[model samples]
Target: MASLLSLRARPAPRRHRWTAALGVTALALAGNGLLAAPAAYADATASQAVDFPTHCVPPPIAGIPPIDGTTSAEITVDKAAPKVGDTVTVTYTVTKPAAGNPVDLALPADIMTPTGKVALGGAQTGSVTVTGPKKNPPVPGKGTFPPFSMTGTFTVTAPGSITLSPGDYNIHTSYIMELDTPCTVTNPPAPVSQTIIASPQPGANERAIQLGTASGKPGERATVTGTKFTPLADVTVVGRAGAAETADKMTVKASSTGTFTAQLTVNDKATTGIVAYEGTAWNADKGAGPAAYTVIDDTPAPPNGQKLNAAVAAGTLSMTQAGDTVQLTSVDFGKGGAATGDLHGVTVKDFRGGPAGWSLTGKVTDFTGPGGAKIGAGKLSWTPSCTTKAGSPSTCAAGSAGVVGSAGATLASTPNGALTGGEFTAGAKVSLDVPAFTAPGAYAGVLTLTLT
Candidate 1:
């Protein structure tokens, strides 16, 4: 116990040393804690370690101008697809304007992106100029202003949309505009857009017409038929041959099932050609269809390879006598009605040797045979009135007085009806007028005819 007490001298002030050691330990622990935690800076310094975002925005798109008149635009697609490989088209039309001064417009050049998505590809810049009206524009009829335009296409990539994907592309067209100037940022036209489908609707529902020929012989008839004819109206059969051109009075109507039939006759003595006989069918709204058939006067052969008579066959009868012109021969009348058949042979001869002045007219009836034929017939009378010919001769010798005359002829064989037998001879004739200036001479006229 005595020895332990003596050691105290060395322990004097040991507390101070211990306190210094404790202080050092505390500083080390604090330094270590600071190393484990990140440094916080209130102010940032410029350095390459930091990152900042940069962005770009396209300019506002232009709009279309206000059109003064009625106009329309339609959008269609060459191909539309969400499944890749689609094309789109938009059509802009301005109508009701005059033939020359039509409403001018613009079209979008940039359709879609290669990634299969729609975009306003305005990557590049260019302008379009059209020739039209200008500002301070003149009155409607005063005079036309110069033409002006400002429309163009741009390149773009896909835009973000729920329906669109990153790889899909579609043509995005803006409404075409009617601009006062190519660069005038003023009123732009409305935009039209369309998407091209991958597959187009089938053409199964389309209508069509097929024609065999356009022209034929006078006694010949043609048949016409077409799909989607029900909507057709005012179908007419026309024949255009040399100087003799005629149109049938009957108009064909289409059936309810979109089909139509028209029977046409080649009665006019027109030169046969590809354009000889024409069939025209109109819709209830007068919409016209393509010509049904072309006409061709193929030499007709009788049944069983028989040769048809080369002589002229008669179809109808007409009489006229004003001045200087007389019936050289009688007229032969064919069957009158809408029926398929050939006409008998008929002829007319001018009795007045030369030009003369006279007035004559007559009615039309059945035909009669020549001298030896045993066929009975009676003369046909007129309506008891005479008038100048419609659209008088455009070209006639000057200083010549016109002659007019009429003749009434009857068959001596058959009393009441048309000639039943082929014999067309021995008919009665009565003159309504004879030209006073006619050369004094014996005038004889004759008529003949057939029907198929």
Candidate 2:
């Protein structure tokens, strides 16, 4: 029998070698003598160590595609030349590709000054609405862009003073669309420029006519001056008496500096009170000034018992009088009727022995009614129709009836040295202005006629 020897196995090596080329790790195992390492054990212990990358390189983000579009604008001014303090109208026309979605557009404007560009006080904005096919038929995931054209108008006031020089200026405006939408868009288009001309203020064209004296006696001369008229233009100065212009007129040529002076004499037979003097230059400019002249008794005092008789013609109208005093009683103003009545066939005879002429003056007091209600004295008026005059009575009524003043309006008068004991006949009409809401009561007033 073979001698059997028992042997204990030793521990394996603590460190192992890894071969990168063979992709295996080698381990050494200790055993008793005569034991050769098995090939299977050595193959199992040899294992390869594989290394992996710790950091990774990320991919890039996807880019957004740009939307192609175009923008254009045109500006026009209403006035070719603008003056200071003038309102300038700016008309703007814009054309742009409209996105299917609603978009806001900004219009930035500035005035091109001599120094530089100055921004406008208020900037404007416009809206573009994508409608019709662009809005109704959606292109799935893609946005709709449509072409559009629009117009807008605005106003700008020029400077009140001469701060801005008189020359050609440009109104510059940039049209831009807001890019806050979902799709990426291109930059806005170029700006638009419009030209305007500014002009200096013109001189005054108003002509002025002045009078030396506003009022003077008849046959008095008044100096008339005119300025700011057309140079070397013919200026006619005439006196207008009542409704008729006097034949006596003066025509003078304006000086080189547009100034003229002339003398206008009042007619000796001119009507008392207001007399209008008119000045006309170059048939385009005209001015008028009123002059009032008073006619008073400047002669010697007449003797006592100077009688003045006023009467109405028989068979025409009844006349009531108290010692050469004609009374107009019972003026009936009917309900809602005209405040007018006729005092038929009135006559006056002046027997005063005086060199100066005499006038019939009507004095009216307030119309007093019951309950202390009164109508104004100015509301009562009298119109004298002097139809017949003997001894050349200077009748106040020439073409129309003379309006009687409440205090002492001239009704009829005798010409100077013409009333040498003569009679003047006149037809009279009286009017009383009554309000619609007048109280229904008896109203009474006194109208006294005196010679002056």
Compare the candidates by lDDT and give the number of the best one: 2
Best candidate according to TM-score: 2
lDDT of 1 by residue, 1-452 (tens): 00000000001121100000011000000000110000111221111111111111111232333223221222222223311111112112121111111223323333111101111212111111101111222223212222211111111111111111011111122234322211111123223133221222222223444446644555667665656533644445443232233463245666667666666665544423211112453221222223323334465776778653332222221221112111212111231111111111111221211111111211121211111111111221212211222332211111112211112221121111111112121112222122222222111111111111
Q: What TM-score would you give candidate 1 relative to the actual structure?
A: 0.21
Please provide, for model 2 over 213-316, each residue's C-alpha lDDT reduced to its tens digit, 9 standing for 90 to 100: 65555567767787777788777776644333465467888899988888877663443322222244212214323233332223445786453422221111
Task: Name model 1 segments beyond 4 Å from true.
Answer: 1-209, 227-234, 240-245, 271-452
Off by over 4 Å in 2: 1-76, 82-89, 92-207, 269-452
Candidate 2 residue 337 Cα shift, in angstroms, is 48
lDDT of each: 0.22, 0.34
Instruction: Report the CA-based lDDT of candidate 2 relative to the real structure.
Output: 0.34
Give TM-scores for every candidate, taking all chains together and pairing residue i with residue i. 0.21, 0.26
